[model samples]
Target chain A: MKLNDEEIALRAGELGPLRQWAIAHQIKVGDYLGARDFVAVGQAHIMADTESLGAAGVDWLERWAALPAEHRLVRIPTITDPRGTDFAHAAQLKQQPWMLDLERRAIAAFEALGVLMTDTCINYQTIMPPVRGEHMAYGDTGVVIYSNSVCGARSNFEGGPSALSAGLTGRTPRYGYHLDERRLATFLVELSWTPRELSDWGALGGVVGRLAGDYSQVPALLGLDRVPSADQLKHFGAALASFGSVALFHMVGVTPEAMRLEDVVPAGTSLKTHDVGEVDIRALQARYAKDVDAVDVVVFSAPQLSLVEIRTLAAMLDGRRATIPLFAVTSPQVKPDCDRMGLTARIEAAGGTVLSGMCFYQSYAREIAEANGWSRLATNSAKLTNILGGYGYRPVLLPMEQCVAAACAGGKLT
Target chain B: MSGEIYYAAAGMGRKVRAKALVASDGFSARYDLDRIRGVFSRPEHKLAGESYQGRVLVLDAAKGGVATAWMLHEMASRGVMPAALVLNRANPIMVQGAALADFTMISGFDVDITHAIPNGAEVEIDPTAQRPFIRVI
Candidate 1:
């Protein structure tokens, strides 16, 4: 398939590793976009729903209508991809009243298609992304980052598109990142501080993401001595996607695609560079400050809580209770283990609830929160902070330790 | 734990802490109400949800952290100590939603509490009033 001008331009912005991989793979170029200069590689969820223009989008819809009618739409909910928990697992809903609603939404979507329904949020590691240098639609910033930087696949920071447009027509807009040459580094982010903590590194991603633009050339991050842990990397990619319109970044030696600072963008060649410090992170959760209040529950999962997070919370709240309640959300993968170890019982005795699979951010609509008079929510994800306010609920953004501590106190961690 | 530290009429320094304090929940005078309220008061003398079922005390974490703690001292004057602890995170309206599911058992309910931690900081309710007040130092 012949790629469009926009697709060509986006591919041009890819980093060297991805760029080279695309060129060597001889992938067909998908055409039909408007942008002529730069196309940032983007991903698709179902791989066929996105369209280059509304016209194409409409045309594809018409064609889908004209089909023989043998095709079926698949729905994947609860878990974006299937890494944990089958698509039909009702145990989550049985255990948590909230899971009932979640399973309903996903089950309706996958009424027939039978989506993999992997529960893990990290699709790149848990599920396979489009082959190296292949263009695909995907959600989750970290997955997008991994696709563009590590797998040589290209995608955008898709929230709705990555999830919805995946099965519309089995075709993308035919623009941005679908071609070679659009993946080169355009902007340079020189990091002058050492990121000691995962949050700090995540902050760096946020700062850079905000600075980066639609046609962002791969960013060459400098000034850090240590590599972030996988979990920390997840935070970094997530934070970057939340603040900036970025899909990926290049941390010189840190990135799988980037090897050196010079490899990002040619020196002094109409390329622009921005510098950031630790301040960007402080501003991320400006809404939820230390102004402590009566915190009843501390939620640990949004994009699926991790085992480390679960263990840490269990330990911190090993023995504590406030005049409030404590709640923790973890993936089902670790739930049975937590139960077997009596972590669940210990926490329950101390007054805390551990939920698996379902999350409050999306699963708990107004009805549920209003039903229980839970007008307030506490969390650390900036995306949740942005969305919770729109739902007529109060969300408390705090650090993990403080969140659990607040829960242990059965009150706010002020 | 929910209750009132009932002070004797026209009395000073004399407090009788009830095991359960029942009141409407919209008390956000302080940004961090839990610690402010929890640090000083014991769990038994906290707040109760939906007509007290046991000898539970009700303490609002919203009132002045220190003021309420000191004021609760008068609760002892009422001879209502040795109470069970019931901490409900819900506003006054959600007796069932914010019930002490972590500690107390409901008659026919097994509620799973889901914690939504946004970037680690407690995602506060009504952040519009906060106006960039969080600090790192």
Candidate 2:
């Protein structure tokens, strides 16, 4: 592949660590991207969300030199009340310095273009639907679904370049996923159980991610509900993205990109099909939960907390005191609103902690993990489950309401 | 269909009449608008749970369902068909960061109940290329 000056720019940059990271990660901007087919780039950011591990923060400038100069930038949104940490997930703030750097980088990138720097991977909620067939690049694991099914947008599971490639050349290298042929299914997922919980879908995501990654291929899931939740879609989307090289998948009744089932499965393709059952969901859940002693502390808001969630926390608290320490992290924008409404005070009064600009998993890794030894984390985010589970932490999956009750009563959702 | 109820509420401190049920999990909505019709028919109702109109009910399908549910109960305490839905991140109710709970809620049960945040088609674009891959399983 001929190297363009812009593409080779990173090889000649000043970011020593980033340069090393690029090489270690085997990243090539132009090799997989084109100059005229793409638009923006969504990357990671710092707001002390769960993905960052809430240490301090990082700046994108750290790797700006290593990334293609023309790449656009957008800040990743904060994930709140995340599920659990999987192998890929380090303790909270595991990538704090890196996150802070990413945030700064996004601000600078936004200066050059309309970089939509949101904190939540759930950017699809805002009508910024990614269209199918359009090349997209993003870093958030769970958010990948929003770009695939809901918005019918397309993109490979982008890693390093996700921060700035969109602005570097206004397009991505037409590589791996740029073509329809690559989008065909290599792995098949058969549904035997209709998932009713986010965690259930998320666990399935983990199974599929692990199973499909056998040959660095993608899976086309059949029989999932035609109308699934945005969160569920993103949850499994992110789970699969982080689980392996899987950048895209197909779902029935949803994902306009896969209008005809053949668009996803295709004909004459090598298919490895696996039938999933309720037993699989239970097994995943059981595997996720090693052994929870008792709920002494409930930490939600691995991602940034939304106002509606804050309101829910307030109502759940209802001037009551939790038996243990309960924490919920909200975005900087909604912090004051929570404070003004006394929701913060209510959560605090309930013996629970509500903090702004920081997520629990990211911020309390060492302290919580160490203090609460064997840290039986509870969450619904599939990405989190993979990260933490990989790290040997068993998470108890629960519904949002049950998590709140546990926080209030200082007990287990189970 | 046992007919699950979908509820959305802002702060339980507020109330909505119950003429119908709000099924969409639009987190942007502050309260279910269809439940408002119950306000006139059943002045005694507060959260839309006790008595049922020939047409409606209430359910909390939004984030912080606890609070939204509380509000549903407090506002339509006398109504029928009020329940709390427990969805996880995979199936989270769609409510953007800055979107106000009160803004997205509509009184009419006619809103499209499609979840726009989970699929590739729902992501926003600003002069940038769409993400080419999503690990959907």
Candidate 3:
């Protein structure tokens, strides 16, 4: 990797020990990916939930945090993904004391490093949306896919350590999605059906993701009858990234980069093409619904709920009462608006818990499942359904309305 | 005597010899692992019900969420993780995790590494080279 003067200085420990370590980390990753140079990134997002970090990761961060303030402060604007536990609702979720302790320690460490606790995967929706071709070091896969596809930003999956390094150094190794040639569509998907519901859109994403198979394949989708909403694309992109490890996608007419079919698709490029229809989405959802008639819990999360989604969920719960635990997780940025608009009240009034600043799966999900005896889970999030199986939950992927209905009938789906 | 050797585009960490756990499937520590049990727990995974602790995992590609970035370090701290990772192609998350954990990893192979290396074969990976490689001994 070619190092500029500033990078050379940082690597030589002229800047600080913190920066020296950061640059060294960047150089290693750059060398691995064959990055020719470093690209200046506008922002950085870190995903450091204690569930993923554990005690060792927290201790590692503390070691860095103990450095002098000037040495540890982030150079660029840095934010965080959802935390492992929302302190207010920790008891309700039944997260253990050790988990809460770990979350607190991790939060303190990040705060010392000057990272904002934005705690959101839907930062594109609630926070800053990057402009076309803007470079960023974003941690969450959902954030990377949405920003790259819809916002036309360039980023690879930076992860927690890499994003923090970029934040400290204000640049990242230029590779993967940062290169324009890699953005070209490698395949095509002809959609036979345009999904109406968010869950349907998510199911479509899961199907297309399975078809793409890996992070290297970018699929350009066509045949959409209308423009999908932000929330719809949110579910779709989140599920696609979760199921496939894909960082970027192009919707031929919907997304910014693929305004026309020819824009992203190279001239005369013979690409592998697949067709997705309503049955494909149904079949994908049915794969998660094996022998599940009763749900232990119903959650609307993964890529936390948008304001409009919150309103829609509140409306659905207005005249209904839930007999089982139903959780509606949203970001800290939107939680105030939900409260001011009574969306939160309406949701809580119907026996639902409106959690803020934390995603369910990231919040010690396995421990909570064990503490609550929650084996059967129902959610509107395809991403959650794809993730929770290994956590010992029988997760059922359903639409928002069906999830609400399941919550009302004491966890019975039928 | 030296056996078959395959060079990787890049690599990191120290050399080690371990039984190869070969699978032509993608890997994500968060999605396909039961961290407590030290096994592949995701039902749909090709290596479901198989133990992965201390083995060299040779897979097709890196897959799923960003949690694996921190998870490798966390898993390493608990002393329950693969001895090393050898992939045909790896996403940035896998590289980031390997870097932070200081774990042995070699990727970007010319051939399908999972198919080339047989499961249960004793393999040694030496990553301290300009062009790192793995060998079946």
- Which candidate leads in TM-score? 3
When just chain B is superposed on the true chain B, each candidate scores a TM-score of 0.23, 0.23, 0.97
lDDT of each: 0.42, 0.44, 0.92
What DockQ does predicted model 1 obtain?
Answer: 0.01
Residues B25-123, candidate 3: write the lDDT tens digits: 889999999987899998888999999999999998898999999999999999999999999888899999999999999998888888889899999
Per-residue alpha-carbon lDDT of candidate 1 for residues A1-414, written as tens digits (9 for 90 to 100):
445553354346432222222322222112112223223333333211111111222232333333332443322221242221222333432234434444444334433333444444555654454566666656444566656766567664333222332332233443445555556676777666666554455556656755653323356677776876666666666656544445557777877657776665656666566766666567655534445475544555544545666666667766676345455655556677788888878777766677665444444333455555665666655444433443455666666666666665655556
> Which predicted model would earn the best lDDT?
3
- lDDT of each residue in A252-356, candidate 2, tens digit only: 556675666677765766677899888977786676555664554465553445676678767877856677666676655676788898888887777766665
* Better candidate number, 1 or 2, judged by lDDT: 2
Provide the DockQ value for model 3. 0.83
Q: Sorted on lDDT, highest at the top, how do the candidates line up?
A: 3, 2, 1
Q: Give lDDT: candidate 3, residue B96.
A: 92
> Each prediction's DockQ?
0.01, 0.01, 0.83
Worst 10 residues of 2 chain B by lDDT: B90-99
Better of 1 and 3 by DockQ: 3
Q: lDDT tens digits, residues A1-414, model 3?
A: 999999999999988998999999999999888899999999999999998998999999999999999899999999999998789999998888888899889999999999998999999998899999999999999999999999999999999999999999999999999999999999899998999999899888899888888888898999999999999999999989988888889998789999988899768878888988999999999988988889999999989999999999999999999999999999999999999999999999999999999999999888899999899999989999999988888999998999999999999997
State each model's C-alpha RMSD to the native. Answer: 21.1, 22.7, 1.2
Q: How large is the interface RMSD of candidate 2?
A: 20.1
CA deviation > 4 Å runs, candidate 2: A2-117, A160-162, A302-320, A330-349, A354-359, A371-374, A389-393, B1-137
Among these predictions, the greatest DockQ belongs to 3
